[model samples]
Target: MSVVAVLRLPLAVDLSGFVKLLQRMQVPHRVSEEAGEQVLWVPDEISEDVRSLYARFPAGDPDQQLELPASGRTSTRPGFVQQLKASPITALVLLSSLIVAAVTLLGENLETLRWLTFLEFRVVGDYIQFTPLGDSLAAGQWWRLVTPMLVHFGFLHIAMNGMWYWELGRRIEARQGGINLLGLTLLFSLVSNFAQYVFSGATLFGGLSGVLYGLLGHCWIYQLLAPNPAYHLPRGVLVMMLVWLLLCLSGLVSLIGFGEIANAAHVGGLLVGCFTGLLGGLFARRKMAL
Candidate 1:
């Protein structure tokens, strides 16, 4: 059978532990060195499986001594630089969110935050004065459509959203590609932001929670349609997010001091996400059948 290179790591990187996992899984592969890089080749058919494993444990895990058919146990996690290289788009989003959070002082600094908010606003002595939506849009401020995803409101808000995005964004990016992931993210943000603006009505609100739900829905439905092991999410993860969504919609989360919940954005993002996943999974299923 023909083989393809699934990974190309720097010369200094070690995959001894990953190799052991491959051996345990009985995946046929070969490792070679070329021009100071380590290249891993596997059968073309199982390339996705092998690459998914490598992305999970780039340096391999040493503590996983148990023999499993296919395990996601970590040996030595990849270094920070390696992670950045592995998922640059995810890293960029997180970094941009961090910068926006800092500059906006968690949405306290209205002057700096106004540019990223969905609507234009002014600081009027401890209060905000919002410009009409039509005015802002007509002024060629198109970036406002999606920049709201970057303007988080609090520490816990950004933290939770960032963590979720990191988990879900990288999974899609690893399987599809950076461009696909970026496009999905932008689409999610645009829809979610607009939904929030319509439902909440010109008030101050911003976070990645809606987009996180989008990613979650994408992976959740995509896996169901295509049944790819790489896209499989834990049952507990699915339950937790769904429960949280329900609670947010019921207003319990907001009533309990977690702040106002963007129920419309979350629901809108999830709806669009499921639709996209259906389309994508159907296409992939068809391609595989051919």
Candidate 2:
């Protein structure tokens, strides 16, 4: 196969992330060391795509590293450490949820959970009363807007949401980048949280369900518009999620003793996610066309 040098960089610069990305995507490439630099070589036919990928992930990203086993060889499947390194934002969110779970005793500790809620609350005997949203905002509790995402009502709640997030979050971070994932998460949280508050009259509800739906919606629409392997989900995943959403909206899930469902939040997040995916996918498609 005819080869062409895609990039030549000083050894001090790390392209391991980029190399790993290529390997994950199964892009054919080779790395060789010259006198004082590392060179990335690829077949002439796919050099442009490799260059495009490099442009997208210069320096291999901050959280990504090229890992070698004790035998001085690369592993086909990355371990937990490597996965965590590659998706720091995802890991951070999961860790935050876990900590919140412990601190609030799975939402049983209302006093501790008050700080993370969208609105401050007071416990009155057997009832919990929430202050007006305006009161919290006026008091400069800005973090309250996004912090609710960290709160979990139960172990099962956090565990299920955490699993979905770990699966979806890493995919977004690996492809769209961490900053992109962070921005999307924040946006989804703000929109979905506010939607729930508006629709449910400031009830206490918290979980990553809304954000998970947003991530799913984003992937579904983005895959359609841009057609990238990273956004390509399994055949029934989208259907299953939508059906679950419908079940929640129908109040069937709540009837089964699953507690109150934040149907509004899920819907809000999904709408916003689809909108973002449309915008992002269109831009990506245009860029690729060019």
The TM-scores of all predictions, comma-separated, are: 0.77, 0.80
Model 1 collision count? 5
Q: Which ten-residue region of model 1 has the weakest summed lDDT?
A: 65-74
Which TM-score value belongs to model 2?
0.80
lDDT of 1: 0.85
Pairs of residues at least 3 apart in sequence or in different chains that clash in candidate 2: none
Clash statistics: count for each candidate:
5, 0
**For residue 94, what is the lDDT in candidate 2?**
97
Residues 105-144 of candidate 1: C-alpha lDDT, one tens digit per residue: 9988888999988899998887879998889889999999
> Can you write out model 2's per-residue Cα lDDT over 220-266, one digit (the tens) per residue?
88878877667779989889999999999999999999999999999
Residue 172 displacement (Å), model 1: 0.4
* Whole-model lDDT, model 2: 0.87
